[model samples]
Target: MIQKLQKKLEGKLPGIESWKRMAVKSGKGESIESESLQKYSDWISKDKLNDMRKAAVLIGLFKKNDEWCFSLIRRPMNEKNHPGQIALPGGAREKNENLMNTALREAFEEVGIKPEDVQIIGQLTPIPVPVSEYLIYPFVGVIDYEPEWVINEDEVEELFILRMSELISSDNGYTETWDLRGNKVEVPIFKVMNETVWGATAAVLSELIDIAK
Candidate 1:
């Protein structure tokens, strides 16, 4: 599965335009984001979004239990934003750092993955997150085997190494109504490790799934 994904990634990526087609519909042609997007319209526009702070995340795939798997981290509950949320290992760009380096460095810090061990396949579309004011660039990488995860407790509460097949399964995807800020909206989510995966993280995985397909 990882080899298949690597080959697909070598060519054209689905990008955010493909994400719109795949992520927007909740199996009923109803958009999960229309309401919240309008609320953030002032900054969510293409021009304004390009000016937002940049961040990057790594979808680190490895072999486990004879299957292809990847990593996700649960943030500490005390985090100022997105507390307790599950995410790919990543953070905001640092001074003089390129986005890919930002992803590699942050992964090493958050989950103890050696940058030298991870062979990057390529990058996926950048997902604009209006609420956090970040344009998140995602890169897919592979390691031969899973490492002994040394979680940075200050940033990561837990690390989950989940099967890529689980991600590729359609049964994990669903939508539910959630109150964002003050408005209730239908939120598309993926149930992974019995935890909710949504927002920009979900957007990244959605495209990865499309690429693998």
Candidate 2:
């Protein structure tokens, strides 16, 4: 499974490469066909938003054995904002955190994934949702010997170990076509098992799917 991901997900990709590529499109008034990602290399490279909202890193840990394969998760429904949805182990970013650090911290807090156990090999592009006014970063991390995960019952309902082969072949996600204030918007979401992961999570997952597939 790890080898499979390494092929599907880049072992390494540059932050600035994305920005340079995006600049080309901006100059010609061409729409960005890129999935969900920022043209800017870093937070400082982009135009400063009136609201500088921060977000967390959603990490997917895939494990497989003789007959089982799954990714880690925390219940999104019943949570304050993104309630009862299926999602990766991540949350809001803390002050003075690098994007990678924020992801590691959130994963640890949400699923008891130790920072040392998970090795981050690469990251997906930045996903910013205008409605939420936050930029979300997604990373690909690997953990050997799945640790004993204890969900923070206060914030999470349970830990879902989702199968990968099934995810790849079965219903991996969803998409919604709607209009926001008369502007047509098509939002895509992922159906991981019974959980529906949408918004920034779905966008980030889309990128991972392209690179990893």
Candidate 3:
């Protein structure tokens, strides 16, 4: 199963065009909206998306114990933004860097995956975060072998490994109401590794799940 999944992913990634189509079907604006995170989309009307700071994150895949799996990180509670939130491995795009390079560099820095070891398959649609004012680009990549994770303590609280099967399973996706900034809002979330994954990270993963199916 692992090998087959690897081949399907590495053999022919759906790339940007597919992502654009999927974006229309399952991106932030379509599938990931919530009352609390709605502020993250408010910037759309300002026509200043290009002016937002750029960032990137990686959806990394690998085989573990004969099953196909992916990775996510829990941010440290003391961090300034999205502290203690579940997120993909990535960060701000540095000067003179493209989105792909930014994703690779940030993944290496936050999760200790060597850049050369990652085989980038394709990227998903870029989404905007109104709260942080960042335009985030998400890339999907695979490593042939299991990685030796050297987590950065300052940035990542711990790592979460989720099987693709679990992510795509209908049983794992559900909604719950939560108090956000004093307003009660219904949030769509995924149950992974016993953690509640919502917001932008969940939004990006939602697109990947649709593509895998």
Candidate 4:
């Protein structure tokens, strides 16, 4: 399965056009996105586009108990952004650093993934996160074996090993009403373990899932 996904990803990615339709288009003709991720239409407004910073995340895949799996982390609740949310290991790009290095570096800092241990296979669509003013690039990588994680307490609250097959097979998506800032809004999410994943992280994962299919 991993090899198949890697091969498909290498040739061509289902890019931003598909992602925009999936993320923002309201099947009901109601404006679900304008209330939430309206930036899917333009990534960022023209004026703020130039000011957006770059970030990257890793979808680190490995085999465990003869099954393919991937790693995810939950941020500490005290975090200023996306606190308590499950996410791919990643952070902002540093000065003079490339986005792929940002993904690998942040993965190492947050979860002890050695850069040499991962074979980067391909990348998914880059998504713009308006709330955080970030253009997030997501990379897919494979490691030969499951890792004994060394977690950074400052960045990670918990770690999860999710079965890649289960994610491919299960009904992982659902919607719920959330109070964002002050407005009551409906949000789409992926139910992973006991956690709810939404926003930019979910958007990235959604694209990954589509590619895996």
lDDT tens per residue, model 4, 68-133: 898999999999878898888999999989889999999999999998899998888777776677
The C-alpha stretches of model 4 lying farther than 4 A from their native spots are 16-29, 32-51
TM-score of model 2 vs. true structure = 0.68
Model 2 lDDT, full chain set: 0.58
Backbone clash pairs for candidate 3 read 40-130
Question: Lowest-scoring 10 consecutive residues by lDDT in candidate 2?
Answer: 18-27
Q: Write the per-residue lDDT of candidate 2 for residues 83-141, one digit (tens) a residue.
A: 66556677677777777888888877877778888777666765565546677677777
Sequence-dependent TM-score of model 3: 0.79
Using lDDT as the yardstick, the better of models 3 and 4 is 4
TM-score per candidate, in order? 0.85, 0.68, 0.79, 0.86
**Candidate 2 deviant stretches above 4 angstroms:** 1-51, 66-78, 171-187
RMSD in order of candidates: 3.6, 6.3, 5.8, 3.2
Better of 3 and 4 by TM-score: 4
Answer with 1 or 3, whichever has the higher lDDT: 1
What is the per-residue lDDT of model 3 for residues 38-148, given as tens digits with 9 covering 90 to 100? 444455456656787999999888889888787899999998769899999999999979989999998899888888998887777677765687889888888888789
Q: What does candidate 1's lDDT look like per residue over 91-164, in tens digits?
A: 99997799999999999999999999998988887777756878888999988889778889899998888897
Positional deviation of residue 37's Cα in model 2 after best superposition, in angstroms:
7.9
Query: TM-score ranking from best to worst?
Result: 4, 1, 3, 2
